[model samples]
Target chain A: MTEQFVAELRRRATIYWEKHPFQQAMLAGELAPDAIRAFVSNRWYYQASLPRKDAAIIANCPVPAVRRRWLERIAYHDGAAEGEGGMADWLALCDAVGLDRADVLDPEKVLPGVRFAVDRYSAFAREASWVAGVASSLTELFAPDLMGRRIEAFRTHYPWIDPAGLAYFEKRCVQAPREAGHALEVVLEYARTAEQRAACADALTLKCEVLWAMLDALDHAYRGHR
Target chain B: MTEQFVAELRRRATIYWEKHPFQQAMLAGELAPDAIRAFVSNRWYYQASLPRKDAAIIANCPVPAVRRRWLERIAYHDGAAEGEGGMADWLALCDAVGLDRADVLDPEKVLPGVRFAVDRYSAFAREASWVAGVASSLTELFAPDLMGRRIEAFRTHYPWIDPAGLAYFEKRCVQAPREAGHALEVVLEYARTAEQRAACADALTLKCEVLWAMLDALDHAYRGHR
Candidate 1:
């Protein structure tokens, strides 16, 4: 079964090879209209809904200290109107992508999978223990690398995209590491036994799969396969 | 946004590459003590929850003809008795795997992401049009191929895993193609507008991603990565 599980993972991972080199060489000046547009549109679910998932995790947290920290982090990501948290900054990037503010705000065009995946993540957090919920978010392990490549690539390959369009990536660079670190600490500290640790590890992997799956849907639906 | 989505998918797909192929190659044969144990243990979610997802889709069906057909299909999969349906058959496979039936039924040990992904999938179906929901289940497009390979691989590589342990896959051989055909017809017949066609395509992609994501998570949590 473990092998079965891993085989499954390998099959999914093979799809990501296409995104390399293209998304990796960036810095700030490299942003493109299309690329920025893609980022804004696709990341909307994550940017907008991540905190909600966090909130669910916080709500379910068995540990008060952990819950408090998560709530604060959630607030930080979802800041007060304008100039605040990640979402607004993400919009600026959306503008960089040429999407009208209204369109971005309007959920009509958003893909259904995005809605389900983000909501489901939050729901899982709501339903499961906070330890496991937090453990599942370990996809941040790849975020820093992905974010770093994105920044460098944006600066390098697609310069027409305004520097402002890079806001989301920049923020992720800052936020993802902090969030990942904190979430991992919680997992390592709180998951007390082998089974629990394995579970935690599984949770994190699951998160990665969710992210990967969303991307796969996008690629298949919108890109070369389509 | 498309590129990022694709990028993310690629990343998840990469994680799947790290599985121990040798073990997976053996997963289909006579039950190894380890493989059987893993199968029974991990399969709980697949057995326990798939019908719920199907029910959600069925509940959302608006067309009478479609609803009736789906209902019959659901019954066939779910069975009338406590120990019935494709899911129950899956559990019998679990027994073949090594898990006590009691533990296999308890969802507590299932990875939180698996629960979220599968539940999210069903929720996506229930929330959308019957056509759209049916479209989302095109993974059958890929299933028969995988099942055939699995059956043959098990026959050749993992004879320790009894053929009975693989009855689930055997059943899927007939089941998936029939279901996929029905679903494909639903989408093609109902999706008249270009946007609807696009949506149908997106739905199929989303389903694939769900499958892909599940696999990716397994790889991350169980195998080669951090």
Candidate 2:
């Protein structure tokens, strides 16, 4: 039954955000320079929000080993003492994309729609069962493939973007699978009941909605501009 | 200084939803029937979210007195049993506005923008300082007058609708002031330091933003539709 449930999760993964039009446009190298900048700026909000989401999960989870395992996610984004970690990589991407770091940092610069979506994502982590929260992040299961495609897409079509800025995606190529594997192990181990398994799938769907809605915000704001 | 901070919170209340254009239109009875239905439908999401927000506060708070006081909020919305409290009042409002009960319960019926905004509000209560969460409920301070106005508006302008549905607003007119007073006392008594007081005020501002954003979603979706 667990194996079947895993199959169901994989089936549901079709809605994973690689299918979002904005991501498709990026992978196809169809996004304009400004579109790329808008994407980077808006996505920065998600990257920044992630540490809080992970911390919320850790705070809610009962098991010490799970909490210890999850602690790395927060550290991965926030770093040891600032100016480091995945957040720093994102800022580098922002710089590489020619966005002003100050503008990227400004809360007002984030579209209301993007703020709404990201807040919902963080809220789900804070409110849902710990296993469900971990399940929602199984989007990482699909992330490595998209990251690889994104790296190649940027290199081939958007060559003007400094290759150094791609470090976030490149690192994620290694990190996401490892993280997803751990998360999957946790969810499979802990979500033993039928209802619990279904909730994990629903949580993943919610996460997918979050990602898709965020891109929808970007698409609305920058799709037609220039 | 706390008095001054309370004044600051009052001053910031200018952005409250009563000032939102959608509310302005509704008070003027300019909303079409469909607009009224959409408002009732979307606003139900906010109504349903309140109990969980209150529960999250109770869960996070250390003081038993505070927890005991806060528990009433969840009860007020959810009632002693399902289908008997503010949620029932809202479903009654939906029926009076010509919406199906099942439709209101259906998650898919909610607008993405409204869901995003409501989720953000719930998340704030779950994730912020317990005092700050209490402070956010300070919108109740301004809510009584709006509830009064809403009752008068529906009776005078939208008279075709059954007056029975107005029970929610009418109850709020009485309940809000009392609730707000308790919330203020908690904020004033517990938020002792300057930084904590500022955070309390900030939480109020965030709550105002949530209300305004919900109206914005309604305005976008039902503004022009007949």
Per-residue lDDT of B127 in model 1: 66
For model 2, what is the error of residue B135's alpha carbon versus the real structure, in angstroms, after optimal superposition?
Answer: 18
In TM-score terms, candidate 2 sits at 0.54
Candidate 1 per-residue C-alpha lDDT over B28-67 given as tens digits, one digit per residue, 9 for 90 to 100: 3433455435535664665554544554454444343454
Give the clashing pairs for model 2.
none
lDDT of each: 0.59, 0.84
* Candidate 2 lDDT over residue span B64-145, tens digit each: 4565466567557765554566777888899888899889988899988889988888788877998999999998796667
Task: Provide TM-scores for the models.
Answer: 0.44, 0.54
Q: Which stretches of candidate 1 lie over 4 Å from their true place?
A: A1-36, B1-226
| DockQ of candidate 2 against the true complex | 0.01
Task: Kindly list the interface RMSD, in angstroms, of each predicted candidate in the order they appear.
Answer: 17.8, 14.5
